[model samples]
Target: MAAVKGCQFSASLSGSCYVMRPRLHRFSVKVPFFDGPLRSRLVSLCCHNPNPDSFIVDQTVPLSKNPTHLPDDCPQASASSPSSAIDFLTLCHRLKTTKRKGWINHGIKGPESIADHMYRMALMALIAGDLPGVNRERCIKIAIVHDIAEAIVGDITPSDGVPKAEKSRLEQAALNEMCEILGGGIRAEELKELWEEYENNSSLEANLVKDFDKVEMILQALEYETEHGKVLDEFYLSTAGKIQTEIGKSWAAEIHARRSSRLKNKLN
Candidate 1:
């Protein structure tokens, strides 16, 4: 059996090799499975198998002589394109945190937007949660929108002594508003859950993201001080020391010392 007209399956399964061995012209045809040189094989087959009775093919109809047609609807109908793109920019626009571009005016680089932070925290959680009993993907998703309420309430950076009840009221109102923000789609509901999960920090995933949230802010504060001056934010240090996990405590110490040194250099 040999392939004919780029139909390798046909050749191997039933037909014979159609190539003249010397004539090697490149030909291509779009078939689901079979592939080979079609024009070269066909011409060779026709030339060599000149006898009409030998090579068993329906010679009355030439495969190459068919005309292709576009349906009438093809010209008039619109093409279906993908839905809107969800890049960092669009995510930023949706988040109120980045509404003030001045917040990112500093030299800190990782997450230029709140969405960027969520996206990366999710990534970090995925990468870090190799420990037993942790659902990495769920944790990643939990991180992606943990601060969605912040998108509405605005960042309450610990310095603002807004009473706990007041902040809770504002943040809860914002959270409730988010239920309707995207019209209660699965995505919006999932984001709302992320906020709840983070706030509760009951599950291992939530706890991991909680750590990441603190870590991200500390990193941002360090970045801000680097650009501005020694100026370590007092709020960050106070919260950092209270973190129970030694993993977090160690990270705080490292950042605190690092920022303190930066502050010293600036003071000079």
Candidate 2:
């Protein structure tokens, strides 16, 4: 009996002879022998093709080599390709173009897109102070992906008629799809984990990032009111006196003071 590497064989009884079939490599072998142990004859079984079109399997066939070894044009060979990353990049473009509907519904013209909001929140995370034992890098990442699912589900405001649980379910599904588009590597897993953390609001980093989120929104609202001269009192009211972190509270307080002075000056 001879054992061959990279190939497996099984015996089938046909009439009074035994037939041996290779398990893979898109080729078959028929050996006819009697009821005695055969020795050393099953060698030289290379399915290496001399011509490309010589072998065809109708069903899903296991390859003798790793799937990555297939020719460049084969789809399985491109399974690990960066094309999926490109698709995710393309999807992210929507984040840059889709305006935060909260502002749009309030009639704020030329409102900031979701990416604009995340960018400032990420910057806040970068310069965040007094976060003892907190991971700043992870907070930045959480800010970046915190609203990423909105690229697919759009920004669901509290008054958007979407139940909180339903909105979370939709956003979670969208996040999974986006992560899959990135081909599910370590970076994708990290972003998915960060996004889940933000969604859960369970960690110190997530708590701080949530504060950054509200602070950024209010900051944007303040800027919009200053530039456009439209009193966005509702925006101020939404986040007023409710910021969770000391940094967020201080920033919100300063913004409110500036807004109040501007209103007083306007009245005067």
Q: lDDT of each model, Cα atoms only? A: 0.54, 0.72
Residue-by-residue lDDT tens digits, candidate 1, 1-268? 3354433323321222222221333442222222353221222333233233333332322223321111112211122222322332243366633632324343344435666667767766766727678788887778766766766666665457788778877887887775554444334445566677777677877876777777766776777666655354653855744565444566667877887787677679
Error of 2 at 23 (Å): 49
* Superposed Cα deviation of residue 49, candidate 1 (Å): 52
TM-score of each predicted structure versus truth? 0.53, 0.69
Q: List where candidate 1 sits over 4 angstroms from the true fold.
A: 1-113, 260-268
Q: Every model's Cα RMSD, please?
A: 15.6, 14.2
TM-score for candidate 2, residues paired by index = 0.69
Best by TM-score: 2
- The count of residue-pair clashes in candidate 2 stands at 0
Clashing pairs in 2: none
lDDT of 2 by residue, 1-268 (tens): 3223443434332222222222345564433233444211111232333332433333232322223223333323233347887899899999999999989988888999999999999999998785788999888888998999988998899978889999999999999999888886445666777888899998999988998888888888888888888778787788766778888898888887887898899899
lDDT of 1: 0.54
